[model samples]
Target: MNLWSFLQDPASWVGPDGIGARIVEHLVYTGLSLLIATAVSVVLGVIVGHFRAGNLLVVGTSNAARAIPTLGLVVLVVTLLGTGITPVVLALTVLAIPPILNATSTGVREADPGAVHAARALGMTTWQVIWRVELPLATPLIVSGIRSATLQVVSTATVAALAASGGLGRLVVDGQRLGASGYPEMFAGAVLVAALAIVLDVALGSVVWGLRRRRSRIGRTAAELDSAPAAEATPA
Candidate 1:
């Protein structure tokens, strides 16, 4: 069960239970968890952040999510729901929502009040100020929260294998079942999960970079437009 031997085995990379299939399964499970978590957390976070209320709720929920062990939660949910992807997705979603919620809330609250006032003075409604003014300003921290949640979900998604949800973790679970004879498979599975997490984090970082760039461009555009009226009104 040497590492080299495992790499040389074409059967490991192809077919139903092979590496490729497992990767696809892993992505599906991970994607669904993120989508559901993001939808719920972002909406709630935006509302709370805009209102600047609910710090107790945010802090309490974040602490609670961190305290719950991912495997235990997944197992409990699977036990209640019967063996399926639904429970696993729920567990991973729980793991993801906290950071996103916290970050979005903080970002919104931290946005400059003067800018918010200006938007209001300009006849922007509360929703308009939030959407056009606050959200753009809060994009960086919101992305940061997403990146943190993404890393956590990518790592924890492996637990899905324990609930009969096929993923790259299948190799590790199978290897563990076979004991010493399956050491190489276990090692390969661990490596794959780590590599996958790294890849996902890097991808998220790029998204953050792009969002910041767009924000910067928007600021520059606004600055130029503001300066145009002043430059034209000059007495000289």
Candidate 2:
């Protein structure tokens, strides 16, 4: 069938329900997977990032997670959990955690020691030093990690369709079942996935940029405060 004919025949892309509904399903599955994965990884990463005791543990765990092959991990989860959204979510979360943990740990460990020391000198609590000094400096690296994790989750969520969770991957899988004539549908699914990745990456990147900008402003304000004359030294 021609591209025009395929477009006109809603069943090709949308299945029997229609294009809008299928698109919503694709987005819902993708969005939920990413959201859950991001939340879990970021929280775990941040907690692990804050202390020396947890550093080795976080690094070791993240490396192990990275070593697991995506398909193999998904298969294993499916075998244990049976086919459904939960197993797919668990698989994507596993794929996502490594980058987040690694980046967050690296960033926190490499945060500006001078600023951290100064915060400590001022009698700031440990949590204050972390929140005001370490986390700000580490924001960029954490953002990078999040960006990587988000992209990975988006790509892997498509595989969830294999377990009967509807997603854009249904188009590709169904097309493959129908043979070479279904190539266009497969290509279309690929295009949608690519577009989704790009959109999410750009959006997360903007958040990182904003964090960096805010950090810069905070640094400038701190510098100005440091240079200001002591209030008690002013002439009476």
Candidate 3:
């Protein structure tokens, strides 16, 4: 069957082994990895960015993480931990950490220095400054990092099927196993994965855009207020 035929077949999208089920499995893997990676990355990034400490450590870890190949890491992890979701999650989480950590750290570090100073001038503690001033300013970059990490995880989660775990990758691997006759299914799997990535990217982009627009509006309002002449002091 051709790619269209494969996709059009009702059997392709229903039942236990159907595309729908596989997509769900793929999302599970992606979601779990992102949750763990985001939680860890955000905390570390906050500490590093807010205090301006751990720069070398974060840089080293991000570099090392980006250097590792995702599929190979998955295979190696499975070999040591035995094939299961745990190994898969661990590998994917590793794949996801660098982008989030870097984005978050950069965002936090680059937050408005004036705002930080003002927050401090108000006697807000370091933690308060981070929570109230730095993080909010850094939100755009942090969200961008999450968006990037999410896309990476979505694309790489297909490797989950390599561990005999069921996901959209199962179709591609199965098609490969079946030779020429399976080409349609393989193509279909690839298409679906690409579509999923595009959808997620657009969605995240909208969020980033909205955040920037809101920030811009706030900046404009603040600027206008600052520039506006104070009412002439009434004669005492």
Candidate 4:
């Protein structure tokens, strides 16, 4: 089959079981996994990081997560749950959690101590200090974790197609089953996966850029205030 044949086929782009449906399926799996991972990991991470407690637990969890293979986890869950969205979402969420947890914990722990102390000195509550000073400053690395997790989830979600589920990966799996005759279809699927990954990554990066810019503004404002008293005292 010609590559153009599959690429040009209007049928592939429309209808209930077409590329559009598959893309939507992929997105749902990815979005759900990211949400679950972020909610669970970030909360725990922030608490641990803020209090500086359970360092060993955080490090061990991160390492353990890294050691577990995503594909194996997906397959294992599917075997027990027997197909459908549940197993897939669970597996993907597990896959997405580690990096996010690591980032959140590290980011908060590493935030400028002066700023954190200043917030505390101002009578800000623990929650206020975390929300205002820590989170804003730690945002860069947190976003980095989220972005990494997003890409991981998107990639892993492809395995859903293997379990008779819908995703862009179905194209590759189906095409491979067709052998050499399906190369064009397989190529098309692979291309779509790469393209989707790039688009998502760039989108997340843009958000990070905006956060960093805001953080910089806050930093500059604080610096100006610090210099104000010095400037007044230095006047001839």
TM-score of each: 0.89, 0.82, 0.91, 0.91
Ranking by lDDT: 3, 4, 1, 2
- Compose the digit string of candidate 3's lDDT tens values, residues 73-172: 9989999999878998999999999999999899889876656666666678989988877787778888899899989888898989999787789999
lDDT comparing candidate 1 with the true structure: 0.83
lDDT of 2 at 110: 74
Please write out the lDDT profile of model 1 over residues 186-221, one tens digit for every residue: 988888888898998898899889988887775665
Among residues 3 or more apart in sequence or in different chains, the pairs in candidate 1 whose N, CA or C atoms overlap within 3 Å are none
Q: Spell out the clash pairs found in candidate 4.
A: none
lDDT of 4 at 59: 79
Off by over 4 Å in 4: 222-236
lDDT of 4 by residue, 1-236 (tens): 58778878998789876778888988999999899999998898899889999978987988898789877887899899998889999988988888999999998998877677667766789999899888888888899999999988888888888777888888889889999988987888888888899999999999999998988776665556555567879959
Specify the poorest-scoring 10-residue window by lDDT in model 1: 218-227
Candidate-wise lDDT, in order:
0.83, 0.74, 0.86, 0.86
lDDT of 1 at 190: 86
Answer with 1 or 4, whichever has the higher lDDT: 4
Error of 3 at 234 (Å): 14
Can you list the residue pairs that collide in candidate 3? none
Over 4 Å off in model 3, which ranges? Answer: 217-236
Provide C-alpha RMSD values for all models, in order.
2.4, 3.2, 2.8, 2.3
Task: Kindly report which residue stretches of model 1 are placed more than 4 angstroms away from their true locations once superposed.
Answer: 220-236
